[model samples]
Target: MTTSTSSKGSLQLFPFLDLKAQYRTIKPEIDAAIQRVMESQQYILGPEVESLEKEIAAYTQAQFAIGCASGSDALLLALMALEVGPGDEVVTTPFTFVASAGAIARLGARPVFVDIDPITYSLDPGKLETALTPTTKAIIPVHLFGMAVDMDSIMEIANTREIPVIEDAAQAIGAKYNGRAVGGIGLCGCFSFFPSKNLGAAGDGGLLTTNDPEFADNLRVLHNHGGHSKYECEVIGMNSRLDALQAAILRVKLRYLDAWTEGRQKNATRYSELFKSRGLDRILGLPRVQTGCTHIYNQYVIRAPQRDELKAALRGCGVPTEIYYPVPLHLQRGFSYLGYKPGDLREAEAVSREVLALPIFPEMSAGQQDLVVNAIATFYGTRAFAP
Candidate 1:
């Protein structure tokens, strides 16, 4: 076994993500796609963007996929399509990125806070019912860190209340719940191509997937300034169309999305085995992939007692790590108008202090992984344990 000290000065530092490695591998195909877009000279909503939207829809098994400017815009557009505005309350988890809640608030809708599942780190389905009132119009269950939320339970709840579900699939592109693709299960699934997601573009991009034709048409108009045709404004809509350049790049990357997802799954398995063998299982809680759900492992996050100290030790040993969300959405200053207290969400508050994401990108090597795992083990070994 290679010790962390042996390669202390010689080891290359691992990054939390390795997009450049992926780019280098598919550079030829990517370059050709860009060249095609340039030669066509149709820079805006052209054939490239249209084709990518169709491809994404086909992949997710949705009737339509509307490309947009960013993931936040995708969520905002979904709410607009549903006509969510002031006096409406959208139930969602406080443990995810701020955009999950911010989108609703942008539409003048209130985002009612809900806690998360301790193991899956998704919106707690049980708490959702209590958060619901007559003002509740929808539930936005975010597939946090590439793991699908408990959609079966969420769907049942939504069906009972006659509310729609807008899936925040920004982190989970190929992830599935009960063999159904994430984006297709909900009323509308929102995806992001923010250069770091599982199916990322060269820059910022987003796509909205839906099975309802009318909802799909509404989204198209919402993304294109509330008009079906250019310069034909109907409703008060904003401009959030996807650029042809990013669409071209995304089309190239989509071909290899399945292969990349497989690699992430394999890496996650390796981390499980390595962590278990090192006897860190007792100290750290590994992520759990629910049965019948296929997790793409966008960020192989773990929960540990000394989460901050572990991150510092990993950095010292040339291993990279990240904290997905140090502050829960309800606790964030941006939503202070909601007037939430610290103990309001016990699970979200507890996990916010413990969750740490390890580098689990497709291009990550076993040697690099060993460095991260060994550093974690060393950190635990040196610290005092509680009885």
Candidate 2:
């Protein structure tokens, strides 16, 4: 509902994510939170970190939450807790941030990728069977673009196979599926506090959520050098612990998260309405929400006709755009060892070429969106729209 006066077709460009705007609104509280951490002089995992973990667990409706150094570390710790090691396979979609699969490979395990659902652009539960094998230890379904995968279908398949599901929910902190928060739906859910995330910290921070107490206990140990007691290491583990400073900052930001999510939701609705009114829906693919799901719109991505060209055109028009993943993970040079050819994962490959992210941050002005849409209209040679 925040509008901007049209610059008569000369739109002023802005950062894709306006973190400063977000910071300004909560400056006093953030400063106090930082001061608290500084005064305590307890920089590592301590009271502040433990308190944040409890808050996150309650927010996600999970039985327990474990904090880690980064989102990548969260995945690594979760896989370690499950004992997924050499020769083991973890199923995930290739159309996501590399950290999703990278964490699997870092543990000397294989990342077995499946195709994505064309409509949802997430791991297609239908094709999951094709990727499962005797070595399959876990299924990692990434909730891409802040939209939850069909949790009902995914859970049914995983439960039948007796395989654990780890949700890659770094982009979906506030998303929900069937009235349950995404991080709580899967066996183990991972979240990131990178500055760009919806619930970002001051820097790198991550959390793991689960209903299983045993898994929670193990994750705690794994995140803390695999020792139930200090200097008595039970197993191999890394030094991945969430620091107190980031935790304190996150505690403050978590309070305003719901309001921010609402702003993003409203922006998404306005974009869709504008696109439909301009008859751009026929040419561009607006986001689709499944029944009983809440998408946080971390990135309001659209499937454009000429995605790369459109992105360039938008840039010329003082609009910024980004391609989430130009290359699917299976085709990446590092993963070529997996021996995947070009068309192996058809839907993922196709989506990689067509998807482009628009600016949908909660603080984005209405005129910024209008300019982006009108610029796209001009690029596609559709009649340009005016506010």
Candidate 3:
């Protein structure tokens, strides 16, 4: 992306995501942890992975936790643990990452797409019961963008039907709902430690949390080639174990998660103030947090009528922006077999066109935020500005 120059003839540029900045902040601790893993020579699922699982379980207040290769695998493991297969259906929002529905499809199950709540951009609990069929096996409600879904309504409907809820909490590690962490609220929560997430690792990694001992045990076995010991096989499974190096790095980062979360929250507040002071809120739709849900701001997305034009203008002015998902899952070519048309989910289709994410990281400075907002102001001509 190209950025505009200042009056003093200096180039300004910002990346969509800056991993190196985070790395530099904790280089020593990360280096030592990696060195320790290399020296130990126990590279597979050893002490480091086990230790991280326990630590995460304690942090989320879950009875058990399991580590896996990626967040995609975490969802698959959860479905496998629950024995979801052909003739079964899994319901989820179409506005989420493909991994949420991909996991269900991989298990030979049908993915039922539902429209999201216009306000929260998450699964609408009111539409859930109507979407359920007699073959519905599980419900995967995503805590989209670190905001907890309407879990009370979802649970009330799900519990009555005896349908399991798998929370796709990849972006909401530290978020809470009614004072309870998002991961432990449902039967199982799947998280992603992709380098860009709020609580991320150096490379691809994921974790799952659950309160049921039997489900946790089943997940552990499924992620480890279905074997409890060496040279023994119990059931059909896949190779999706978490690496020791990733576990070590994650442990170092976990210590600062709360602090970083606070930073993000502060930045979100500042953005609101800046937009409101400039009257940009009249043109853009700011995020809304529910009363009982605490948002972690995994992404600070705003809706603008001229989203595409504004994004181009921001790029020209040295501010980079990204679209979380340009298209919903049901309309994807691969899922065309689901027999969905454009009008099936009107809200999701309309939202996919207007949502745009601005730069939001824990290490970002206030000046950088100003630069971003200034660029937007210049584009919309909302307030007088100089290039």
What is the lDDT, from 0 to 100, of the residue 362 in candidate 1? 96
lDDT of 1 by residue, 241-332 (tens): 99999999999999999999999999999999888877788889999889988899989999989788887777777776779889999999
* Pairs with steric clashes in candidate 2: none
What clash count goes with each model?
Answer: 0, 0, 0
* TM-score against native, each model: 0.95, 0.96, 0.96
In TM-score terms, candidate 2 sits at 0.96
Error of 2 at 29 (Å): 0.8
Model 1 deviation from the true structure expressed as Cα RMSD, one decimal place? 4.0
Superposition error at 46 for model 1 (Å)? 1.2
Q: TM-score of model 3 relative to the true fold?
A: 0.96
In the range 1-387, model 3's lDDT, one tens digit per residue, is: 434454445455856666678899999999999999999988799999999999999988889999999999999999998899999999999999999999999999999998998889998998999999999999999999889999999999999999999999999998999989988988999999999898898889999999999899889888999988777799888889989999999999999999888888888888888988889999888999899999899899998888999987877777767798789999999799899999899999989999999888888788788888888887788785333
Task: Give the local distance difference test score of model 2.
Answer: 0.90
